[model samples]
Target: MPSPIAINPVSPSHSIFKKMSKSPTNLPASAASYLSAVSQADAHARARSLATTVTPTTTPPLSMSSSVTVFSDDNVLREGEPKMFDNDDGLSYPPIPPTSEQVFTTVHSEFGHCANEEYRFTSQHPPGKPVPHHKELDPPYYILLSTYISYMILICLGHLRDFFGKRLKPSAYTHLLPHNGYAPLNSDFDSFYTRRLKLRIDDCFSTPVTGVPGRTIICYDRETQDYNANLHTTGRRTRGLNISSYNYLGFAQARGGCADAVAEVISRYGVSCCGARLEGGSLDLHQTAERLIAQFVGQEDSIISSMGFATNSTIIPALVGKGCLIISDEFNHASIRFGVRLSGASVRTFKHNSMKSFENLLREVISQGQPKTHRPWKKILVIVEGLYSMEGSIVDLPKVLELKKKYKFFLFVDEAHSIGAMGAHGRGVAEYYGIDPRSIDILMGTFTKSFGAAGGYVAGKKNLMDHIRVRGHSGPYAEAMSPPVLTQVMASMASIMGVAPEPPKSANGTSSNTLIPYPGPAPAHMLPNWFDLPPSLKDGTEGLIRLRRLAFNARYLSRGLKKLGFITYGSDDSPIVPLMLFNPGKMCAFSRMMKQRATPIFTVVVAYPATPLVTSRVRFCLSAAHTKDDVDLILKACDEIGDWLDLKQGVGERWSLQEIMDRAVELVHMDID
Candidate 1:
């Protein structure tokens, strides 16, 4: 195995006992209080780290392989302090609250303040306008060559080190060797890729973060002495502008209407649901949430699962069997693939978001039928995501629906990233395209992305949902969604749908029940009688505001970067914007540079395996919590860093950094060919 790269050397000087850096002077009370509280917590954490320090001889836990998201002690508000931090950090807060409205009660760090209605935009696709396809931009020749060369160099160096390390340092190779007649746990390729290539840039991934991962996330400062085999917290924190987390509508918060409801539910029902759905775990909240979700997605019924991944992986098998076929998009999420693989159903993938490719493949499969026996398949399920996570592309739902009508395949649209982020009313790709959501056979989505909650849901006809509730793996085996999570989902979903007036009661003082139509308000009785949202949230004004702000930010950021001469991917309305970095070295450099800026900006970078090898890029997940100024800050950072890293090799109508920022609204509205 190749020796790991040394990122930061161990030293006593880096200890937490060292004097902390002074926070910015003249901060607002909320900002000062938050910073002060965070400092005290850091001191306590350092003391604990000292007590638990391990000796050099001890084997360190390899935490570098996974991303770490930790909630800090800061989540617990100090006594006498306001529950909401409207100005938790100086960067996110507005200079003056909107005078027309009542005092803003939101934590600015969680949801940014942008009072200008002009800053908002509806996310619906233009009528009669062609649905945009995924556009791939190529970099300059030398850039591509260097990217390939960088990988080649890394591979060659990794092999050379592995060859020598095995012979020279036999102790490290013990695990790989057949000792005591047991087979090695990991393959040679896995070990080499991990130790050599991955370790070098491990610092860029899975960074330990503390506090709410909203507009600004607080990352724990840590260093590794022995490459990335282990991480050591230095008892320091860096509050960076977070363009990394999947907080599309900016619902992820420690203090909000939704959070209050969640806290109340936790107090009432505790955390766990006690058991699986089929067991004694199901709650009235689950049924209510399912009803609201069904209404939200225009489905007759819905089923909730405790986990997002399991919702797909578990229910998929129940939907299909051995003789069934799953026609999937090439770039579908891993969870979808896992579910398809377990179903024992045949799968055929088309070029991602390419309607022509999908149509051709569908025709071929329909004609040829099953393999070997050449018998007609029992059923075919076509699966695609409403929005691609890595590529930031929106699936051409109109085209897919067109094909579905002709081929008669069951359509499944995964709206994990699209729900609560797309559409004029925040409904998903179907709504974005001005189509009925029920036109698709199945609509699967997760609360983790846009709802600021946990778990997933499957919505369709009442019979289909009833079948899934009974036959799905999650029903009998998996634990049910927690009470707090269920409450959060209900509160957030209700806030989006708005609470409708109670139906007229008869002389007996009892009202009849009725299902609320799609895009309509939730019936007032569906929510807990004690759960009362603020006027803004109850009326769905806040949700509408969030949706519009998210659309604007998404469009402005994606368009601004493209005009600044960087190769980018995805639709203009997509909150997920991917700026191509190409080379692996550049990926690390881009992330580090952005994070190290004056107003530090945290971003997610992707390379081979997660994305295509040569198209290594930084993905900026725009949020409704971000203000117009936040988008400008991101564009400025990217422009400066892109120029430094020689990344502006994209072919486009180039605009200077200032021009792009100045005319952002115009740029957002500009037609893209």
Candidate 2:
């Protein structure tokens, strides 16, 4: 036999060691053949049976060096390259290529492996073939399970720490000696008592008089019967004549047509829309309500929402977005302020009805000019209220209109208090001043105040109204305006129309010139001033005639209160009359005293935070519903309360008529009592 063939190693000893260290699963072909030769004949046969039945066409493994030789069962060993082994049959085998497992092991031994050593794969299988080298190939699943188990362990440890960390340690009291030198009590008993005593104790509790504690007319808990009982008491007692509510026109509790309209709404649709508008929540009543509002205000279109607050908060924001400026009156309603804030526009407040201030602000803006590269903030919105809710003063509409024209700003007026109270046909302050309704961009009002309903509407051009209906946050996001409730609005509008007097004709034979008084030096069709007279007779007329009657009623009430020695504040034109009381405690006491005398006077004790402490008062709201008898009864109650308290009139009252009127013209920094 030829001498055993000399076999040269494929690489340097260090390199071979490195490869072997990297992958322990890899074996030299020489070693494998030697093992195969040494195994029992039966074991060899079993191994052959487990091997792939289909013959694989051998291909060389990837390598950077081209000089390396690879050997298989069919290939003869090359001469230049040294082989590792030669079998009895003169066949030789080269070392087996390093497997992935061997490479990983080699790397781990020399340069520590990743913490997850078990995740490394040893072989790459062909498609559809089971992974042959490993017992399980889904190592990621096992890793995830391990991670979850570790997390749970950490969580449980944290919970244990939290539970024990909060526990209180025992103190010297636990070990205190008994008087007889024996154990004082059982250990469990002491522990229980200690735990109970450790609990935090609170001192504050609800007092007997916890609710509103003045007056016999209950503002809340409408079912409470003892009108003279303390409203603040913890018991089911109430006081005061609930007059703070928004029933300005007395339509809420009125008899006849107004009551019937409310009933009709209830009959058509149940209370509440059940869901916001834009869903299946809007009823036909909502449409009718909008129609009635549009007709009443002489607008092209209108959209109704659940509340006046919604009307403001939703509409302004929807109409004005980025690149817009909002010019608001200092005394504008909170709703208007909220709307402007939501609009994301630059806001500037003008002095209350100060045309000069508004002009100056506009001049500054115009002088600064706009940037050339960006779109200028050209869209300007001017917002004001027809009447100030707290001060009972009217906005200077003519001056505001002049500013609107000069700056080309859209005008939005809130008629919460003025609607259904002013104007020739009770159309609102705009109509009262003979302003063409079309000129006002947006008119907003609430049913809760005048119409005695629970909704509000925004009247404007048809396109703007349409945009608001769809884009308004309140209209689409909140509860839809009920349809049945809208029907009631229509009925109310019809009733108002029936009661409205037709305009008297003028000698000029034009319908436009018909009921206008104090027509300025302008055309006959021009709007009138406060004094009801044509240019020829600027002194007085039918308009003044009606105004004088209303003023007479107001002065009559004032005289009655004065005769009873009760000081009253507010102008003759304003229905709101406030009886002054500086002390909050006295306000409650006086209200209770008056109620006990069987006189139910509708009034509210304005207190701190709602009004200045110095201006605390009992506010009485006079209405069209009140008659002479009703006024007399209210005056009598005031006298009785005054006599009971022995209250003497102050020397100089801060709430005098002149002071109130002057303050009304000034910017309202805060709410008036």
Candidate 3:
């Protein structure tokens, strides 16, 4: 059998072990078969590069000997390949070879005074932080089944390799395995890291797409360097329809009224705001944007930060401390979780959207009191998302509010995905449920997704916002939002709140509504039954129609996917929809299959670090600008993927477009008001 390791022309055994450590998957194919497959794939990639090359002159072949070493492709592992998990400081390495892409070492921030300190001081966040409050908050059953299976495969492969490599039994590597079958620490890092390692040369993350993220967009495929091209390779760039990106409300267009406002601001203020908010960055635009945001979200006041992630990450730490406890939904965004961790507060997670589980938690906490202390806790914060981005499910805000009343816990609602895409007036979850927005203690949102802008805000009572302004790290430390980004956000908010885009002047100089086209129009049949205005709503503008349209499309598409046999998650009325695809390989395979199709469907694949390794899925976000035809195209594309992947049931297999249309009509009840 051939050795599984890359032929390093160095110590072969050591090279074998090093390569093994970098395996993307734990599945162990026979060494000979694996090597053969790699050889053929490598040969094919080389042949493609050679075929594309226009060699003006030929060079003599270099001499080959036992001393000659062959490097693998950019994605393939070598003895000392670069990776995010690389622990080596690189100081010990030989002089680095020239490379195409810029490679640089990251210098971690170090404090000088600390190295010379004879002084003693104590911080609230000591290393061995809180003795974790047990599953007092987790679901009835917390399972890491896929992760466990993945680890077991790793162990088996290790043992098999040991046996093959002149070892009588499991070698010292076996000693590294967990004593019990189960690992104590539950982390998705290993799975996520390994997955990323395989995708080092893949364009699944953050592929640039032109136009708003709606029905269709032009996704760019940048020129990729040839596998063996040591420096740069001049490859052709291609563009395809993009169905990815989070421009939920159609505000991310390259040319529009809001875009014009952004351009104007960029010209006037230059690119950046130039400093943090508390320093020299504060502008009249910033103040105006904050005021408008507060008014839009029905808040007493609001504070802005340059990033959504930082807003949550920094604000949570400012709000709570050692004495407080944070009760978050199980599947809350990572930023929220990080902020919770940094706060030094005892955190408990309830089953997502489970009111009963949340109440049970409240009862348990109230009954048991604080851990180790048989005394009452200082403050308890209940955090949940208005609409979960991954699951596409809406939180039962009214019920949660009821519980908040019962438990007297302060409620923090993350409206990151809900603000401009939900509620009757798009005031978010509270408005969706016909409840008062002020009932929410802290209203947090981001402009990146819905507003097609950059930055986020924390809005609530005047006092709360004031405290965040003064105490939040973002206000004093982080750079303020760029002027153009700020203006874009402002214009987006204005448009959503019944303000129409200004009529464009025709060549004749008269205002022409014809030139100023209404950006989004909805399918009449897909509109929801509950879309009727209550007495409180005095008017419904073009903006209301757009929101309703988006809400309907999410439901419409979800129903279609489900009827066709594909497993999906999220509320029917939600814009965020996740189609569950379990196999680790299937995630990349599915994405590639869609992109290579005649009509490419651009999709974002989320696995491992973004979710539990077990819950890998392809998230599809619906936008108001996505026409029914676009949604239909996606449905058919997903159908083809299901067929190729051999997913559960038939899904889109048995039906033609006609059948799909029939089902969609029935499911959405097309004969609606």
Candidate 4:
């Protein structure tokens, strides 16, 4: 077997770069100057020399040494002191020239090359400071007024068009109108929002892409000749910087250890399990994954469901019944609402992420008891998402815990976005806030976000989980989670947890390991015998680095946008950053402009029903795979486009695009309410 190679942050040979090395004397003019700047005496001198001469080499050196130490590439000169370069447009390759001594092991498109350790940060709440609540910073009055006016205009125009089209072209309105005897399938009024407002920007949503949605994505180009009702593929493909996909930990890849494990599982186990868990479809893999999930979340036991939404929708009913009351956050996801409705339980909601409002509502509900009957409720369940999807805000768990102690209500935290994306150990919000995971009554999370796999898990006390396994609708109704997905989950999770060194063998040659602690390494016996992971993943080094990189990217982009004077929402450590574009027209404009940039950038825009009317905005999801240079590019693009769209309505002490890019680290560390 070949020896495992040790990859350094400064190594130059990355998968994205072509294998080419130049002698020191034969280096390009830009590369020569960059090297000269690296060895310069002072910061001012280095800046003066690099301003005009520094540019990334199109063909960088390929370092193959087992042990190589070299100056890191791009904006960062070393670990702490990061310098910005403006000479080259890093469309296809890195902008910084790499020395022959540098060797990077990751694929540039899937996992970016970021060697600067100073950029990394731990996503955790500051001890002394209070938890940050979701505070809405309203845009200028004109911006809000224009947003309302834009929606009004769209509605009026759509109604006018519908009236004229129905009379002039009856065939066009046939589906919306009555046929011979049957009533219209969908009334025109019911879908007014979709037909009029959403239809104009239909092209911006549900874009067809051909590759893994990692750092960059390849999108299929399509055109709609007559309105957005029909779209035709143009047979052209554009590779864009992806800020859209929910691949939070940047695990969505086609060529990693996780992918290899998934491929192996497919060949061994085939695809489907062919039946539900209660039937003959139960596999040993499901039980193994469930156990790992429980350990990962610091719970006693957990139940796995085939789908993320189903994990909430089907399991909630099993936990509560007709007499129970579900006090939920107003901004909870649709799945939570669906589950509550099906559970036959009474529901109440408070202002989103406002603990004071929640407490007041809780007091009223507890005092009032069941509606109409005014009798004591059987049980009260408080539900909230660890990370709200649309707003990019985190739940105030500490306050919720305090309230729980006083009020004695069950707590359920939906960590669909927070798991593997937040915290020092990738244990979700509980770890992020320094709270014990077991403190929360139930911890529900999905593998789709961070594990690069399908399905979801709900963890809690062993008895509760056992009951849910047998009683939940998913047990006998839904198809069992397939083998490939289970393998992907186990592989990715093991990489996060990491494998412990083999236990010491007794004189009789029998293993002598007894037990392991929570949040500790996974035992060898837990994984399948056929599983073989790479050294980096086996030791958990790559997983730790990815978590730090994601933290840096999240803070950098969120602070960068705010510094550039764009009204944004979310915590500084949140992976979801939403830049507000109040006008309804700007939603489509922003998405299109970003996609049509010199180096195409894909974005997700939320409007109308997804968010409040005036809060229509473009949401940018940061990933561990994005390098500092990638963030710089996004900031530069937004600065130029923000001015054109008149979207910089934020009131603050602002900085120029260049200054923000240069002082990214300082900005991320800035203390703000």
Q: Can you tell me which runs of candidate 3 are displaced by over 4 Å? A: 1-197, 200-203, 206-215, 220-234, 274-281, 500-541, 650-657, 662-666, 669-673
Q: Local distance difference test, per candidate? A: 0.79, 0.48, 0.60, 0.79
**How would you encode candidate 4's per-residue C-alpha lDDT over 1-673 as one tens digit per residue?**
3212111112123322211242122222343355454444235444556554443322221111222123344322542332222212222333332333333444556667666777788888988678866567888788878888887898898999999999999998898998999899989888889888887788889988876788887777767655677766666566667899888888898776888899888877788765433323578888888878888899999989999999999999999999999999999999999999999999999999989899999889999999899999999999999998788899899999999999999999999999999998788999998898999999999999989999999999999998998889989898888889999899988888898877889999998655478778788777887889888899998888889989989999988888888888888889999999988888888888887665678899998888888888999998988878788878988999999999887777898888987888888887876
Clashing pairs in 1: 67-206
What lDDT score goes with residue 58 in model 2?
19
Every model's TM-score: 0.87, 0.51, 0.65, 0.85
TM-score (C-alpha) between model 4 and the true structure: 0.85
lDDT by residue for model 3 over 451-552, one digit each (tens)?
A: 888889988999888888888989889987788888778766666664333456779986543311122221111121222222111123435555655665
Give the number of the best model, judged by TM-score. Answer: 1
Which candidate model has the greater lDDT, 2 or 4? 4
Pairs of residues clashing in candidate 4: 11-102, 11-103, 12-102, 12-103, 56-95
Model 4: worst 10 consecutive residues (lDDT sum): 2-11
Tens-digit per-residue lDDT, 1-673, candidate 2: 3212111112222221112222222222443343333233224434556553332121121111222333444344333353242222221222322222221111111111122111111111123332121111122343335435644664576445434544553243444334356775645344432222111110011112222111112322211122222122222222223334444444443223334555555544556665423324455456545655676787878988778787898889988976777888886877888989888888888876667788898776556544453456768778888866554456767767877787777889998777755554456767656677788999988776655566788898999988887888987688765644554455444434332223456688645433222211112222111112221122222222222222333344544454445555543344455666654345656654543333233355654445543445666665433333334456556666766654435333234333332332131222122
Better of 2 and 4 by TM-score: 4
Error of 3 at 648 (Å): 3.7
lDDT of candidate 1 vs native? 0.79
Candidate 2 Cα misplacement greater than 4 A, ranges:
1-243, 261-282, 354-356, 365-376, 499-571, 578-590, 593-596, 612-614, 636-673
